[model samples]
Target: MLLAIDVGNTRIKAAVFEANTLFDAFIFVKEEFAEKIEIILQQHPKITTMVVASVGNLDPSAFSSFEKRTKIEFISHKTKFPFQNLYATPNTLGIDRMVLAAGAVLQFPKQNRLIIDAGTCITYDFVDADDRYLGGAISPGITLRYESLHHFTAKLPLLTKSYPENFIGNSTTESMHSGVVNGVISEIDSFIENYKTRYAKFIIILTGGDADFLAKRLKNTIFANSNFLLESLNQTFQYNQK
Candidate 1:
């Protein structure tokens, strides 16, 4: 079995995969990194190889517990990927985004792909049909929007994410929900429409903590899987072995 870990800005997700089939998956916060990973290690002794893709400030030492038992690797710009990265600022590209692009290529071949990750930040990454990764955009995510509203302005209390009761919010909390949730839905739909105008037969992949929340609201067809980055990490590791 192979262990794949994706440490994002907000959460750390780990999964055990036997070939392409996922055996088990776990998600936790960074503070629980050592404890959670240790438990996962104890539970899945068959995971001989571990690969991590991180876009957070997690210390590398957190994985030392696994190092003694498995061959571990971290994904960086230096890591080998199947897709050709054409981003102007290659060093600035997030390893998580790069892995997602690689996963799209491996999972869905011969097509243009747009990957939207909705977590701390909503990131849009595009990989063309020819397997060249052209950079995409990033925007404030669901939580960020709520936090921004509360932080930047006075009297707007920080609110947990919830779908707007109606498009036309009647109260203060309702308005904030509409602006944050409905606004993001509109923004995503606009991006999909624009991408469609330029590319034909393109596939949109939505992943991250807020994927399920946005999936129901999005009008465009998308393959939504929250574990995409972890899956891609395993795919990248397997490809490197070959």
Candidate 2:
């Protein structure tokens, strides 16, 4: 069994994979990192390897105690990837994005792939048909948009994400909801449309905390899996063994 860990911006997502099939999954904040992971490991004694890809501030040393029992591997720029990265600033690429691109290349061979991760910040990473990693874009997610509105203004109240009853928002809270949710949906659709114009044939993969929420709203066809990063961590580790 393999323990795949994704240390995202706000939370840690961990999963147990029996080969390519996911057995179980978890999500917790950094405060619960040590206790949660310890309990998970104790419960699944078969997990012999823990592979982590961190885009957050959590220290890798948090896994130090488990090193004696399970091999701990951190995915970094030094880790071998399946695709040739074409980003101008190659070293600056996030490990999370790199793993996503690697997952796309390994899972969907010989096809152009665009991965959209919708969490604290929405990120788009594209890998071409020839297995070249071309960098994409990043924008604020729904939560960030809502927080920004509340933070920047005095009267506008902070709100959670909610689909607007109609595009035309009549009230304050309703308008805020419409702007954050619908605006993100529009931005995502626009990005997909723009990509469609450039690439005649390519696959779109959406993953992250808000993936499910936005997936149904997207106009383009997409493979939506919130657990893609964890799965990719497992694949990346398996690839490293070969």
Candidate 3:
């Protein structure tokens, strides 16, 4: 059996996979994380492989200690090039982004694909037909944009709700909400239009926190996966074993 983990800025997720099938998965929060991680690993003592992807470079020493306790193979790359090196400086590209796009390419090979992750930040990544992970764009997520406005500025207050009204805003809060969500919707629309012009029959995939929220608003159809990075870790495990 293989255990996969994706560490984001705010949470950590775990999945147990056997025979290329996911058995179970859940999110372990930070408040009582050490106990939760220990319990999860204790129950799955026979796991032979462990794969991980993180938004930021987590201290590998911490993970290494856990792997030593579990007797499982740990896989993580700070600078390893999994796919063709296209970026000018491969070290700057986030491993989470690489895993996410590579997983999509594994699922849908020989096709142009767009992966939009809407979490701490919204990222758009493209994989060309050649299987090269061409880079895309990144923008503030719905919540972060709201929080940034309040945190960075003096007058603006923080917001948690969303607006489904027309583009124009009526009040100060609505004005901010409209600008964030509506602006993203337009941004995605324009991106899709530009993608379609270059590639024929491209597949669009959306993931991360606000994927469902944004998908509901955008007219462009997308395949929504909540555990994209988990699937990517699974794929990465298989790739390394081969």
Candidate 4:
């Protein structure tokens, strides 16, 4: 059995896997180390290999303690990844992003792939069928778009990022929502439009917190798997083990 943990800026997701099949998982928000991990250890005592991809300030000491207690080694950025890393700064690359590319490779084994992770930030990564990571692009998410407007302007209140009443907004709140959500839709459309000119028939995979929120809003069709990063973690762990 294997244990994969993905620690994001706002929350943490941990999943148990058995022979390439995910078992159970849990989501933990930002909180001090309580008995939560201890409980997890007890629940999956058979988890022989542990992998952690953290985007936050994760203490190595805690994972070390798990190693000592569960007799399982931890997989990290230091762990060898299977694909050829093309990122200019490998050390600076986010683990979540790496896992995502790995996941894309496994899911669409022989096809060009594009992964769009829409969370606190939106990241666009691509991988070739030969397992070449072509790198990715990143930008502020919808919420950040709203927050930026408020921060940049004096009277513009911090509007929530959601679907607009209509594309043609007739009010302030509606206009803000339209700018954030509809803007994202158009931005994605433009990216796809350009990418299509370069690559023919690359599969588009979308995931992350804001994925569902804007999945239907997308102008172009996309495959949405909210647990993509976790699946990627599992694949990465297995790849390193072999």
**lDDT per residue, candidate 4, 1-242, as tens digits?**
77777778777787888876878878887574336677777888887767778887776676666666554545556877667788888888887888898888877888889999988889998888778888879999888888899999988989777678898889888889888898898888788788899888899999988888878978778999888898888887677768
Q: Tell me model 3's lDDT, rounded to 2 decimals.
A: 0.77
- Cα lDDT tens digits, model 2, 85-192, are 999999999999999999999999999999999999999999999999989999998899999999999888988888898888999988888888999999999999
Candidates sorted on TM-score, descending: 2, 1, 4, 3
Q: Residue 140, candidate 2: how far off, in angstroms?
A: 0.5
Using Cα atoms with residue i matched to residue i, what is each candidate's TM-score against the true structure?
0.98, 0.98, 0.88, 0.89
Q: Assess the local accuracy of residue 95 in candidate 2 as a C-alpha lDDT between 0 and 100.
A: 96
Residue-wise C-alpha lDDT for candidate 1, range 97-152, written one tens digit per residue: 89999999999998999999999999999999899999999999999999999999
Ranking by lDDT: 2, 1, 4, 3
Best model number under TM-score: 2
Instruction: Judging by lDDT, tell me the better candidate of 2 and 4.
Output: 2
**Strongest candidate by lDDT:** 2
Question: Which segments of candidate 3 are over 4 A away from where they belong?
Answer: 43-45, 71-82
Report the backbone clash tally of model 4.
0
lDDT for 196 (candidate 1): 83
Backbone clash pairs for candidate 1 read none
List ranges where model 4 is wrong by over 4 Å: 43-45, 71-77
lDDT of 3 by residue, 1-242 (tens): 77887877777788888856888787866554567667777887767667767674455565655755554444445433345647766678787788887788788888888998888888888888788877888887778888889999999999885864757788888899898888888888888889889887889998887777888778888898887778878877687667
Q: Tell me model 2's lDDT, rounded to 2 decimals.
A: 0.94
In order, the Cα lDDT scores of the candidates are 0.92, 0.94, 0.77, 0.81
CA lDDT, candidate 3, residue 87: 72
